[model samples]
Target chain A: MDEVRNVIELKDVTKDYGDFKLDRVSFAVPEGTVCGFIGQNGAGKPTTINLILDVISRDAGEITLFGQSVDRNSAALREDVGVVFDEMGFHEFMTGRDINIMMKNIYRNWDEAAFFENLRTFSLPSKKKCGAFSRGMRMKLQIAVALSHHAKLLIMDEPTSGLDPIVRNEMIGIFREFVMEEDHTILLSSHITGDLERIADEVVFINGGRIVLTGNKDEILEKHGILKCKKEDLPGISESLIVSSEVSSFGAQALINDRASAEKLYPGAVIEQAALEEIMIGYVNGKR
Target chain B: MKGLILKDLMCLKKQLTTFVYVMAGTVVISILYVLSTRYGNLARVGEQLLDQNNGMSRVDVKNLGSEAMVLFMFLPIVCVGDLMNVFVADGKAGFYKVSSSLPVPLYKRVLARFLTIYTLFGLGVLVDALLAVLLCSMTDIMSLGQFLGVIFSGASILSIYSALMILYCVLLGYGREQYAQVLALLTMAAAFVIIKFDSVRFFVVHVLGDGVGFDSSVFWKPLDFIREKGYVLLGIAALVSVCSYLLSVRIAERKRGVI
Candidate 1:
């Protein structure tokens, strides 16, 4: 993949809402890639997405979407950008057909046939009001609309936060198919790292409004490892290099981001590949 | 723009059933009132017909026709409720975020909502007027010209009121529905006070009921008032709509954070 070609770019974006501040945060999602935006709740993932979509104003920083500055061409840029929120924000009284009609006029390139096709594919009712839909159904409806719009970039804020495993897997499959085109890309933020591990090509981890780590999925998984040792040997391990450490009666496990360095430094330690969830948890709860 | 209006109409579809029921009820009540009074006293009915033939002035009957026209005022209250639903429903359901994210310009969306409410209100008033006419036709109490005059005059007042109500929806926040109802009641009370007070009779007669009577002379003054004051009301409406549009745009531009 060409890493330099960025479809979505944020440069030192900062937003201050009096009581809270989103510090200077920046990341990039290259074209034809699925960038998993991993963060715990209140990690400023949604805030960053809102700024990029220009739903909320930023105090400082530049957001570029689809290779154009978001500030200069918000309408033009939004034309090709599809967005989905964790909660379906549509009038309860409105049906799928009503939404399609409303969007048809709002979007210059709205395809009714494509929208209905997606609705049928997802088994969403055209006449059923949104208020009656279950959470999963509503999320599916939002995704159907987002994908049918021919958007190049799909920015979803926790789209799979509350879903059964089967539905979550199905959505991940749909997302994978959505990015099959060379021009298509997705930037999804979620605390559910398992789904990301299954489909994402790259991962961007944000904590307390700051980007802690960002790189290829394979590289992050391969480089970061968990070091397990007997409780007695835990005192012998170097605390400076451990990202996070968990103590238990049976043993102690420490997450070390640099697996090769940990192996060289502690030859007696048992190093095992760490899952994305464990790595995220360790990063959030810093090592003691 | 058409699509926005269609969506609003779809949302209002449930309310249409209520509107129809109220309209039918109004018609039935008016007809019943006429029947109970006119047919119960055969001798008095004969005397009324004889008086009409003798060209005796029926000013009291004309005042009653004017009073009957006030029933159309209820239309604005209902229409305001419908418009408020659009905002409250969207806010509560989180649909505003989804709709705002669409590529449509914010101003166009606001205007579409305004047009939808205005159109629906206009249609409701028209139906009420038709019902009034049908009820008046079944009795000998009001002349056809007087009945038609009442309908047209009532519709004119409703047009101005509907415009003001739309402005109210845009200027006030979500709970403005209750405020609008209170304001409507206060306006009626003020009108009644002006009608009763001898000192303000000139103002009320000139401002409130200028075109209400059959005389062409009485129509000019209030028509001019509407013309002059119409600009002020429209100007305020335009300003409020623009400001609300900008506010919504600003809200959309804010950065998301932990709430």
Candidate 2:
């Protein structure tokens, strides 16, 4: 495998907020790859993003973006980075045209033509206030702004959480288009595993502020498997291979961390490839 | 920096009507002060004398001075109000957090806000001085020298007050909103207490109460001190404004949240 360059790197990042602590989390997003940041509510997704953006200071750690320290490059290097929060982060009173004008002044490389083109393509009126926009429309507007700035890295948090299926698909398609340039990267944080499954090249799962899994999507899927066997046989299976399991009167379905070992050990049972959602659920359930 | 300032200006564009209303209110209040002082008939003095048991209808010059004080008093309020409008609008709409994600430096963001508030405050002071000069002349309430003194002294005091108000708004912008309110009340209390002191009250009355024909013997010493050192006071106000701005920028840079 060719060594890929990382565009976003978090090394031993830690943040303490009295009630919760993000304990020494570390991950890297390679260039041109869609890195899905998977976590449940209160799992420190926003906190990490905030630290990267310097919206809040980090307690301890080093974050580098675009080959520069985030602390030192906050102003200069941010020109090549785009960010979209779960909320639109725009004044509801502003129209799309207003935002375009504002962005033109804000980003030196802001492509006015591209922004307008996006508005037209999205069927969003340039003069209409964003307060009147539908949830999908708001998400589209943010995506448009993120793309128009000539950003090398796009960081988005929950960009598709509330969107309808069609809109989410459209957003995914847009992400695919963005990554086609071979230099563009995306750090997309979403709870919707299906969207990540469709588009993400790499996945990083975070639970309780700690990274549980980080690797290529295909490898993770291949390494973990679901083994179905009689309920009585679950206790007899090797505990090391079992991530988590569900036992019922009819049978037992267990998620195995190592598929080859599980297949070798349970010769009579059926083993199926685990989806990303199941893998995440298995880890989460295992913690309990 | 220009972009950040432009964003604030764009946000303030919606407040044009409010600006007009505030100016109109200032004019009405100025006119009332002029009428109450120059045209006491408007206060219904003759009717008050006829209705009351006492036949004497003395014009309450102190009351008129208080009313005139309110006209200048409104300066700080308008200054504070305009600054609040820009910050509150950005905050309530979540654009402040959005700005943190942009390429603009945090210092520039803080500087933009300081510039916006002080720029508007400076403009307000100019308009206010002009209004005072015109109304005082039209009513023949005070001599030209006294009006000049009024302009110099009033502008200096109001500038300091406006700077303090900006500091309060900066606190609010940095999300110490509860502290902002406390600071505002405390500042107001301190201002009133300071004003009640003989020296400060004498200076205030010498400038603002010139039209009321105040007997200067009681405050002659402080009044003379202010006249000689008036320019120094202006310098002090300028110094305070600059220091407050620097402090605000420092606080804003270290702020942890958007609001």
Please report the candidate that would top DockQ against the real structure. 2
**Reference contacts preserved by each model:** 0.69, 0.75
lDDT (0-100) at residue A279 of candidate 1? 93
Interface RMSD of each: 2.9, 1.3
TM-score of chain B of 1: 0.58
Tens digit of per-residue lDDT, candidate 1, span B1-259:
7877877777677677777777667667666666655666543654575587654345444334334434443443354335655655655676557755667555566667667766785686567557656766776655445444444444444444444444444455444556754564566457548655763564457656673433433434443333234454345445544554455434333322100
Please state every model's RMSD to the true fold in angstroms: 6.1, 5.4
Candidate No. with top TM-score: 2
Model 1 CA RMSD to the hidden true structure, in angstroms: 6.1
Superposed on the true interface residues, model 1 gives a C-alpha RMSD in angstroms of 2.9
Docking outcome class, model 2: medium
Q: How does candidate 2 score on lDDT? A: 0.77
DockQ of 2: 0.60
